[model samples]
Target: MKKKNKSKWLVPVLGLALLAPTVLPTSASATPAKKVTSVEFVGMPAPATAQDMARVYSGASVKVTYDDGTIKSFPLTYKTLFKSTDVINGTPAGVAVDVHGKPIMDRSVPDKPVPFVSDDPDSNSLMKIDGAKPTGLGGNPLSLITHYEYITSDQSGKSAYGIIPASMSLSTIDQNKATGELSVTDVKKVDFSSVGGLWIPCNGSLTPWNTHLSSEEYDADARAYEADPAQTYVSSFTKNYYQDDKKVGNPYAYGYIPEVTVHADHRATVVKHYSMGRFSHELGRVAPDRRTVFFGDDGSNTMMFLYVADKAEDLSAGTLYAAKWIQTSDENGGTANLKWIKLGHATDNEVKAYIDKGIKFSDIFEAADHDTPGFTKIKTYPSGKLEWLKVKPGMEKAAAFLESRRYGAIMGATAEFNKMEGVAVNSKDKKLYVAMSYVEKSMEKDIKGTDASDDIQVKKIKAGVTYEISLEGHQQDKDNNKINSEFVPSLMKGLIVGEDLPKADEKGNTAVVDKVANPDNLSYSESMRTLFIGEDSGMHANNFVWAYNVDTKKLSRILSLPAGAEATGLQSVDHYNGFSYIMSNLQHPGDEMIIPEPLKTEVEGYINQNFDNKRSGLVGYISGLPSLEIKKWKNTNKPDVTLQVAAKANGAKVTWNNKEHTVTVEKGVNKMVLKVGERFVEINGETFELPSEIRVKKGRTTLPADLLDSFFR
Candidate 1:
C-alpha cells in the first residue's frame, strides 16, 4: 500500500499523496535560478533590526530554484528588487513583495523603503524575474532654487558670470506672477536691448508664432500714470536709476501692461493689449480655434474670464466677460454652482452707461476690493427690475456667489473676492482647471487678540477641472459628426481645495463666520459655489500651474513652484526631442524666496501637514523635466583584466582615488591627468582607458564617471 508511508505528517497522508504529483516531482537540480533585474534604496530609515531584512544587500548574489532541479544566481541590488513607494500610507504601505518576493512601489512617500538581500540560494534569472532599473530619477534629493541675485562672472571657455544684485521693475518677470527679486545673471549684458521690462513669475505661454505673452498681473501705479491716454506724473519703482533718462516712452512701457514679446528671427517685438480685462492674470489659454482665450486673474476677489477677439489681427480688441457661478440643488439637497459667465453683445451706449457709474478699470485683485476709496464698482441700475434684467452681449452673466470671511482677506477695498490664478487644459480629456488664491482678512475668526495678531494667512491654489469646448463646435467631418481627439486625462486626480478655509479672525480669535467652509454652515461664503477658493497668504502664494479633467467635475493640483514663484512660461518638453524650461523671478531687491517668520513656517507647514497621511493616486507638484538622461555609458568585453588604456582627446580629464577608491570629477574633456593617493596616470597617451567595472573591482573610485570618462575609450 504505497510502501506504507513510514511517518504521518501534520497534513493528512492521503492529502500529501494527492499533492505529491504537483509538488514533489522536481529534484535538487530541477529548480530554476533567481536572477536579479534591478536594485533601489533610499536614505530614509536605517535597518530597524538585524532581522528587519530591509537592509540593502546590493551586488549580492541571488539564486532561484526551478522544477528541473536546477539553480541560477546573479548579483542584484535595491532598486531592481523593488519599485519606489511614493505614498506615505497606502496599499503596499512600505514595500510589497511580488510572486518571487520582490517589491513594487508608489512614489509619494516622503521616505523610500530599503532593499533586502535574498539569503536563499535558489534564485536565478531564467525564472523570469522582472523589475525596473535603478533610474535615480524619482525624487532622489529635493532641490529648491530661491533668493535669486544676478551677477556676471567670467570663466574660461564657456561664458560665465557672477550672480549679483539686480532688480527688475516689470509687471511680470519671466511670464510668471510677480515674485520678489532673485539674482539670475544669465543675460549677456549686450542683450539688454532684447529684454522686456515685464517680469511675470510664471504661466507665460508662447504665441502661435513662438513669442512670449506676459500678463500684467497688477496695475503698476507708475505705468498707469505714464501710459494712460491722459497722463498724470506719478513715478513707479525704478532700477538702474542712471538709465531712467536714457530709455524711450517711459522705460516703464517695457514693464507694464500685459504684452507679447517675440524671440525668434533675432528681432524683439512687444505689444500690450489693454482690452483683455485687467486683473491678476495667470494664463491666457487660447482655444483650439485660436480665436477664443480663457484666463484667470489671481487675487482675493478674482474673475474667471474669457476673451473673444473681434478680429484675428487685433487680439487686443476681444470682448471680455467675467464668469458668474450659477447655483443648482444637488441630490443631497445641497446647492452647487456649476457654470461660468460669458459676455454677450452690449451696445456701446450700455457699456458707456456702466463705465460712467464707476465700473473701475481693474484686474482680478482690484475687482475683489471694488469698494476701496479709489476702487469704484461702477454700480448700475438696470432699466428693468433685477429679475427682468437682460444678460446683454459683451456683458458677462453675473455670478450669484459672494465672498465670505473664511475665504481670503480683502486686500484693498475688500468688497468681494475674485482671486483665480492657475489655469490648464488637457486636450485629450477636454477639461480645464482653475486655481484660485482667495484671501480673507484677519479678525474674521473669534480667537484671542494675541492669536489673531500672530495669525498669518496661508495661501494655495486649486486646479479647477472643467470640460473643454465640445468638438461639435469645431468643423465637422463629412459625416457631420464630431471627431474624437486622442487626448487622455493625465494621471493627476482629485485635490482638496480650500480645505483649510480660514476659521480665525485677524486677531486670531475664532469667529462664527469662520465656519462658512463646512457643508453644515449657512454662511454667505458657504452658500455661494461658482468659484473654488484657495488660500493665497502663506505657502499658497507660491503655488502655480493647474490642470483640468473633463469627466469629473473635479480639479487636480498637478504642480507647484516655490511660493511667490509664478509659472511665467511653461513648455511641456516635446516627448520627441527637446528641452523645456520654466522661467520665474521676483521684482524687488531681496524679494527672492524669503519666507519671513510666519510665512516661512507656513511653507514648511504646508509640506509637513500631510507628513504621515497618504492620499491614493495623488500626483506630485514637480517642476523641471519629469525625467532626464543626464549621463550615459557603454561597455565592451576585453581579453585581459588590465587592458591597454588610453584616454581619447574628448577634452575630458579623468581622476580617481585608490584608498577608499573614491574620486569625483568636475569637468568632462578629452585628455586628463589622474592621481590616486600617491599614484598618477596620464590617460591621453594610452590606447584605451581603464574600464569602470574593472576599476571598481580593483578598488578604484570615480565621481561622475559617466560624465568624465567614456567607456568606449
Candidate 2:
C-alpha cells in the first residue's frame, strides 16, 4: 500500500524471524510429506543465537518458510566502511587539508590567506584510472581517485585571494594496493573562466559517458540582471565578488549547468551548457537515451523542467519544456497527472547572440503581449494565467531560451514544488525519482498577481519526500496531443517520506533511530536495485543516508553524519572490476570552531553557551563486502578444508601459538581463540560452537572455509 503523506513516519519492525523448514505434501494420496531445505528472508540478519533473534538490527536478515513450501534469503555480509577523518597527511604547498581530510585551502588561496569561512561541501564524484574497474581506489582494479571539491560558501567579505562567495577545486588520492589505504596527494583550484564561476554547486550526477554534471543552485536572478542591468543585485554574496561582471554586463553567464570532463591523465575541462535554460538548478539527470534530460528547480514555488536535445548526448542545442501539475484526490500523497508546456527552443550560439546584442530579455516578454502575426497563446487548464508565448521573431525566441523560468511562468507551469533537490533515473524500471526537501501549503501560492516577488507565503509545512515518476508509455503522448510533439510529461507518486525527531529529554538525551529529515540527493543502484537517499536538513540533530529496497519496500539506515552536517552525493558504482561500491559525502559538519572576524566573537560566545564544537565534512566510499583473506590447506587429504577470515573495518590478522595449540584471530583489540582440532571457539573465555572442527595442514592450523561467517556477522 502507498503512504498517506510526506510526513508519515515509518517505524521499522525490530524482530527477526526464526529459522524454519517447509514441509511439502505429496499428492492427494496418503504418502509421506517431503521437507523443503530452503528458507527466505527480507534482509539477511546478523548471525545470532535463538535468544538474540528478537532484537536483531533493522537491516539484519532472518530465514522463514512459507506455507507453500518456498524458501528465500538475502545476501548477508559485513563490509569495511570509512568514516570522516580529522587528519589528511602530506599537505602540498598552498593547500591545507582540514581535520576532516578535506582540502579547505587550495593553490588559489594566497599565502597568509584570510580566515577561511565555508559550509556545505557537497557532491562526490570519483574519476578512475584508464581500464580500472570499480573495486574501489584501493584495489588493483582502481588505484587512483580524482576528487572534486564544492565550497557552498555564499558569504560576502574579503579574503586573501579576492572577494569570492562560491568556488570549486580538484584533488587527487593515491591508494596503497596492498593495505587498501587512501591518501590525499595534491589539491588545486579549478579554473571556471569558460563558465564565469561555479555558484552553489550542490549534489551532482556522474554521466554514463564518464563525465561530471555539476548543478548550479540559487541563481535565478541572473536572468533579471541580463534583462535589465539596473535591477538591484539579487544576492549580496554574488554582488561583492562579481561586481566586475555586473559592470561588464555578463550576469547571464552564470546559471546554466556546467560539465566537467576528467581525462585519463588527470587533466580536466569544464564547460557550461547555455542551451539548458537558466534557473535555480538542483540536479540534472540524463536519460538512458542520452537525449532527454530532466532537471529540478530548488526553491519554493518553482517549476520542473525537461530538455530534449537534437542529437544524442548533446545538450548545447535543445527544446525546453515546463511541467504543469494536474492534481487528483491524492495530491497530498504526491500522486498527480502532469502535462508538458513547451517553453522555447534554441541553440547556445543563437541565445548568446541576443545577449551580445545588448537586447533586454524583458522586452521579449513584452513583445509576446503584442498582436504580432503568428504569435499565439497556449492555454493552461483551470487557471489560464500560464500561457505560452509563441514568439515569431527570432530574438523573442532567444529570450525564451535565455530566461527559461520567466518564460515558464508566463506559460502556466505549476510553481508548487518546495526545494526540489535531486533527480535520479532508474534505468531498469524506466522510472524517475525527484527529491522534494520539504513541502508546504505556501508553495501553492498563486504568482499571477505578484510576479515580481520571489517569496511565497509560508502557511503549513510537511517533511521531505521523494516522488517516483513513471516514464513508461510517455512517448505516446506526443501523438495524443499534436501540439506536444515529442514531449510527454508523466505522472508523479510519492515513494518515500521523511520525518522529524522528537525533542530531547530533561538530560538532553535522545533515542538514536533510523530517521531522515530533508531528503536532498538521490541515486539508484542498477546492480542491487536499491535507491540511495541523502539528507540536507537543519531540523534533524544529525542527517543520514538511507538505502531503500525497491522490491521489498524496506528502508534501512546505511550511514549517519556528525552533528550539524548534511549528507550529499549518494551514488552507486557498478562498473568497477565486477564489484559494487557507494560514494557519499558529509557536508558542513559541526565540529570545527574556526570562523571569520565579525562572526568569530558571536560564534565563540554561542559555542561557549552551548558547549558543543564538532565539525567534519568528508568524502568517502562504502564497500559492498567485508575485507577477506583466504589460505588453503597444502595437503591433498584436506579436500574442501581451508582457513577463512574476514573483518569489517580492517583486515583481520591471524596469529597461531604452536605451544598453546591455539589460533587467534585479531582485529584491533578484539580477539577470538580456536584451539587446534576443536569444534568450538573462545571469546573472552565464552565458548561458541563452530560449523566445523579446526584442522592442520603443512604444520599450519586451519579452520573450516566458512568458520569466520559468524565472526563478521
Candidate 3:
C-alpha cells in the first residue's frame, strides 16, 4: 500500500532550466523544494570595509509563502558556469577575434586584457537547440549560449568611451545526465567581421522561434562620421575586425539587429535584420505572437519603437513605427495613451542593398542647420540634435531603418524617452515592461512639442521607473492599415518607482537601497508572479538584483554584486526540462563610482581582493530554486492552476511537445512515465493501465483529479 497524492494538476509550460552541475555545489542539507508559496530573498549589509565593497555574495535563501499562509525557508545558492577570465582552447572567453580568427589586442592596457580576457562581458542569451551535443557524460540535449563582451574598457575603466569592437561568443552548454548540472564543453567566437564586427553589443533577447536576437547599442552618428572619418571613435573596429586601419569602415553597417542561429555541433551563424529600426537597441523583446516586437532604445531623448513582421516567427522583413505618448495622468511616473506613427516599411535585403552600394546619410536626407522651405525640421532623440531634412526620394527604406531615430522624429513620434534600457513582456497578462534607467533630461516636466523630442514631461524620479504597457489586439497603424498583430501597446503606466533621497544617507547613498535604483535589466516570471530587476546605477553604493512579487508587492534583494558593477544578462525562461532559471550576469566589477574619497578607495580595494588582478566579470544563475513552473488547469469538476505545481512539487519533470506531454517522476530507482491525453502510461519499459485517462486543454497537459491519486500513490 502507498500514500495518495492529494494534489490536483500540474502544468510545466515551455520553461527553461539552467547551468552546469558544477556551477556551484549545493550543501548536503539541500533538497528539491516540494511546494512554493512566495519566494523571499535575504539581503546583505551595506559595504563599509574593503572586504564588504568588493564581495560578490548571495544568501540565496528562499522563504516561500504557501496557500494556507504557512512559510518555510530554504537555501538556494549562487553558481557560476564561467567567468570572463576563463579560457577555452588558448583564448579567454568572449575575446574579439580577427577575420583570420586571432585575438584582438587592446593597445591601452600594459598587460592588455583585450586579447587576454575581455573586461566588460554583457548579455547571456541561453537557448536550447535540436539534437544532442557529444559531451564527456555522453550525448546530452544540445544548448547554445550566445554571450558577448559589451565593450572592453582599459585598466583605468573607460567603457564605451574607449575604442573596442564589441564581440560575441557561442558556448556549448548542456545538462550532465549523471549529475543533473550544466557542462560548458566548448567556446567559439561568432565572427562579425563580415558585417563591421559588432558595435557596442550591450543587451539582447531570445526570439519566439528559439533564436538569439542580439543588439548593437550606442548607434554611431553616421552623418558626423561620414563628414569627418578621422575623428570618429569606431576606427578601432576597422583596425581590429579587418586587421587594417585603412579598410574604410561604413558607419551604417554596424547598428542593425543581428540574429544568431545555433547548430547541433555547437556552432553559431549570425544574420542582421535591417528592417527592424536600430537606435541604441537594448532589447528586442518579441511578443508571444512572434511577429510583433518592442525595442528599448538607451540614451537621452529616445523614442519607443515597434515592428510587425510580415510573417510569424520571421524578423527579416517588417513595418516600423514609433510611439507618440498622449499623457493621461501625471501621477507616479505618468500614464499615457500611445499612438503609433508609421515610419516606413522595408525588407532586410532592401536595406542591406543600400549599405552594400555605399549609400551615405546625405544620400538619404538633404539637411540644413536651419528651417528651410522643403526640409522637415526634426530632432533626433538619442542625440538631441535638431536637423532640417527631407527624404532624398529614393532612399526611403534606408532612412527608415538605418537612421531610424531621425526618421522617427520626422514622422511625429514621441522622442522624449530617456535611458530606456530593457524590455520584457507577459503574454498571460497582456503586459509589457520597459526599464527607464534615469527619469531625467528628456522625461522631466516640460511643455509638449517644443523641440518635438521632449514631449514626455512627468515629475522627475531620477532613481528610475519601470513602465507597464497594456497590450491589445485588432489595432491599426498610424496610416490606418491593420497591424495584423495581437500584441499592440495601447497604454503605459509606471508599475514600479524607485525613491530618490534628498541627500546622501549615512552610507553615502543618494537613492533608497530598499527600493530599486536605476533599474536597467528586467525579466518577468509569470508563474512566480515576480518581476526581476537589475540595477545599472550611479546613485547606489552597491548594486543588487531584486525579485519583486507583483501579487504581494514584496521587494526582496536576492543577490549583491561587487561595489561598482552593474547587473546584466537577466532573462526569465518558463519551460526547460520542467525547470526554471532566473539568469543574471555581473559586469565591470571595479568601475569608478562617484562616492566620496575614503569610501571610494575602500570599495576599490575590496573589488581588487574579490576580483583579483584579472578584473573579470562572471556568468551564472541563482540556483536551488523551487520548481514553480505549474499553471492552473480546468477539469475533473474544477478549475485549478496548481495541477503542474503539484506534479513538480512531487519531484516530477513535465514536458510539452506537439500537443503531447510526458510526466517523468521517480520514486527510488523506479522511473514512471505518464503521457497526457492517453489512457495508459509506462513504468520504465513496462505498460500499466491508468486509473483514468489524463487530458490536456489549450495546449497545456493536465492531470485528472481522480487519476493523480493513483499515479502518485
- Candidate 1, 1-713: lDDT as tens digits: 22222221111110000111111111211122222221111112211221221111122222322233333222222211111123222322122222222332222233653321111010000000012121132211111111111111112212111111121111101111111111111111101222333332223443443334445443323223333722421121122212243422232232222444322222234455545543444556554545556565544333445556665434655444443332232111112232223233222234333323433222112232223454323211110011111122333311111111111111111212234444544443344444433323220221444221212222322222121222223322223432222221112222323344244333221222111111100000011111122222332333323222222333323223333222322233121111112222111111123344554454444433322111111111112211111011222332332222322243334455456443333232223333443122222211112333324435534322332323223
lDDT of 1: 0.26
Query: Which order, best to worst by TM-score?
Result: 3, 2, 1
The most accurate candidate by TM-score is: 3
TM-score of each: 0.40, 0.66, 0.82
The residue-by-residue lDDT of candidate 2 on 1-713, one tens digit each, is: 63222221111111111111111111221122123232222333221231221111124332423234433222232221222223223322122233222344323434644323333456666556674333334434332222223332322322322223345445565443322233454444455645555665666777767777777776535434655645523343344344433545355655678888766555668888778887777868888878788887887657788888888877788878777777653444456777777777788887766657765545564435444555434322112233335534555465567666656665567655678888888887878988888866435444464332222333233556788898744353222443322324487877886544365422121322344467888888764567878877655444566777777777766564544456765776654422335666665555332223444344344433322132224556553221111111122232343444233243777777879777777654345667776555543222333445667777655543333433332
- For 394-457, candidate 3 gives per-residue lDDT tens digits of 7777778888988888888887888999988887889999999898877876555557445677
Whole-model lDDT values for every prediction = 0.26, 0.52, 0.71
Ten-residue region with minimum lDDT total, candidate 2: 12-21
Question: Candidate 2: deviation at residue 705, Å?
Answer: 10
Name the runs in model 1 displaced over 4 angstroms.
1-203, 219-257, 263-265, 278-282, 310-319, 328-417, 439-577, 584-652, 655-695, 700-713
